[model samples]
Target: MSKSATIYRMVMDGHICPWGLKSLHVLRSNGFAVDDRWLATRSETDAFKEQHGVTTTPQVFIDGQRIGGHDDLLRYLGKPVRDPEALTYAPVVAIFAMAAFMALAAHWVVAGTLFSVLAAEWFIAFSMCLLALQKLRDVESFATQFLGYDLLAQRWVPYARLYPWLEGLAGVLMIAGALHWLSVPVALFIGSIGAVSVFYAVYIQKRELKCACVGGNSNVPLGFVSLTENLMMIAMALWMVAKPQLL
Candidate 1:
């Protein structure tokens, strides 16, 4: 077999190891065969350790040369490391699209049809919230596996819960406003809350913190996309505040 075709051994300790699992998946995705026999056994680990003087699991060896961990393997595979700046435009586009869609829907559709739009918005917001919560959970799992710590995991649950609930409430308020029973103030309130959340995400990203907005899927640093999203939400709030009749 060719060198690249040779089955490589990856030694991993726990199933919860993100780096190991990610590396294994990436390797396999890149067409490298990984030998799972080296996962979490003293005998397998000891043999590799004696040969390479490595004490940790997630050891990668190719033709008997130690290749270190995930980062190293990623480098070896020549995959472009994630760059936050590169992803800035995507959020901006998404926000603009959302704003345009909502505006068109509100304008073209009468008040009677608003309920259907509100329902769609409710489902979307709920879905986004669920995705965010799931991402937060994955982040917790990742932190625990890598750092042997669960501090963020404990704190994230409560803080994260508020977002979905607020989003769902906003959807409800939109529906109520559409029914002409509630004033524009309710829709404004909901939009304001969303704007605040997006702005805060922007602030966090500006400070170089990773955004947990969409959860683990968000690799892009919060910047223009977040800011734009916030501004759009605020604009929507203002529109709703100004025109309760449209709702």
Candidate 2:
């Protein structure tokens, strides 16, 4: 004889009937067809209670297997019951550091102190820019290693090292003020570049790509954290450009 298809059984008092109804809705939503006949108390099967040792209403059985009660069902749905508030200390630190540096730059400019504080700001900004570009280099290096491709061996690609070189050069120009009018544009350009890099990192994570950012310390999903950091950096760069008197 062919074995009968196992029917799901649920029992609930009127007070807890809504939970069963909601579970039925979810079952239907997930494309599982359920017979409500098993829900009727008058004709319900005692076979389930005898086999599974269930002594409670709101008990559930699927395919002859006990699935537990209402609370257990909700827990099985994988919905987040609680989430911790996110922290943002890194971005906060970057903002305060930039603000302090700018204040010192402003003081030096006002006092007509030639080439001390201004040079310091230039060097600091340059260091930050280089660090950001280094992140890009690390990404490229990782891709090559993972893909096992000799990118430099192919002349058509030629390793694409020019972009980082240009970034470093831009840092130099920001320091030298090659064209006094170009300082703002350079700062804006550098800021724009960093913003794009950070955003691209976020985009990759959203697409479920493994992040090569910060050498594997950035395994966390991209969200408000990356966005805030990028925005802060862009703001700092713009502030430096618009008010050159504050470096």
Candidate 3:
């Protein structure tokens, strides 16, 4: 015999509960024949909640065993739940992935090619802008975190605050293929300082720290990832100077 479950969920004209849909989908995906009970109005939902002695809807029952809401349902199935407070590299990874996609898409549209010297440049520039935006979202927070390990930022408070703006401006100028004289110098100066700072803090000092590369609220561990960001900037700066000569 097949497993069976019943779910009481909110389904109204103006609003639909996403948790309810998730619950239904989970049950069906797990090979359960679900008896979906839709609470169509405010009164109906309230009445159901009162009858069941529960505060929330999207309640699931399997063989008279109550499986609470979406989170509870996942627990019942022995699934790993996401912890929002946990430290993760997800933000940085997502930004890089998005930058790569955007670079490829822009190159395809303009150059009728998937790969080129210009596309590679676009990828790095786009990543720099996106990463800078994350830090700029809350400059004070970013600066505080940055000062913890960044050598230059610790000595010069204003540099900590202005770093994101400088990074973003250089990226924009590079992308526009304008003001190479300004962009190249900015990228090189900051990138060299950042690389030296990160290398000393993480490798030489062997001190563990959080990366300010993503933002102030970032949970990404400082080390390889932070070093990579600076190195890429340095490479891009040098490339900007040499590319014209080669092409």
Candidate 4:
């Protein structure tokens, strides 16, 4: 036998309760025949709330038992609740994903081919620019968080402030394919410093800290992702230095 559920929600001109619609959809999708009841006016909604002893719309009932609102329905349906404050790799993943996609697009436009060493160069360059932009968004916050584990930043506070600008400059120069003399040195120096700092902070000291790689306000952890980002910079710097001789 198909189960049945009652969903009471607001449905007026220019004022449809979205949660109520979602509740009805969930019930229907879950093999339940939904008894959709609409509160068509302010008084109707108010009276419905008062009569049901509830304060909100989009209330659901299963087997004559109240299932509350959207969140309550989710809980009853066994869905995981996502907390906004939770730590995640989403920021770093987005940075790398977008950088790689942009690099490929640039490569295809300029060279007319997806296969080239320049693609890798562009990827690293775009990654640096994007990452630096995140940091530059809130330099003070980034520097404060960076100083917690970065050896150079802790020793010389001003370096923390300068790091994002330096990175941004290097990225721009690399992207423009100009002034390798300046950009290579900057990339090499900062990449080396970052690699050493991340290594000691994560491996040796074994401290669990937030990574300022994306920005000071980010929730990325100080671990493999941070390490890989620095390594990529170092490799790019080395390639830029050697590309002339190789050609």
On TM-score, the candidate that comes out on top is: 3
Pairs with backbone N, CA or C atoms under 3 Å apart (clashes), candidate 3? none
lDDT of 1 by residue, 99-157 (tens): 44664466456564544544444434333334334444566432332121112234464
Model 4 gets an lDDT of 0.92
Q: At residue 156, what lDDT does model 2 achieve?
A: 33
- Candidate 2, pairs of clashing residues: 11-58
Residue 49's C-alpha lDDT in candidate 3? Answer: 89
Cα displacement (angstroms), candidate 1, residue 126, comes to: 6.2
Q: Scored by Cα lDDT, where does model 3 land?
A: 0.94
RMSD of each: 8.7, 16.4, 3.0, 3.7
| lDDT against the true structure, each candidate | 0.49, 0.47, 0.94, 0.92
Q: What digit string (tens of lDDT, one per residue) describes model 3 on residues 45-75? A: 9998899899998899999899899999999
Model 2, span 100-194: residue lDDT tens: 56646754776665355455556445554543454465655633321221223233343333334434455566556565355445445544654
- Predicted candidate 4 versus true structure: per-residue lDDT over 165-211, tens digit per residue: 99999999999999999999999999999999999999999998889
Model 3 regions more than 4 Å off: 9-16, 37-58
- The weakest ten consecutive residues by lDDT in model 2 span 145-154
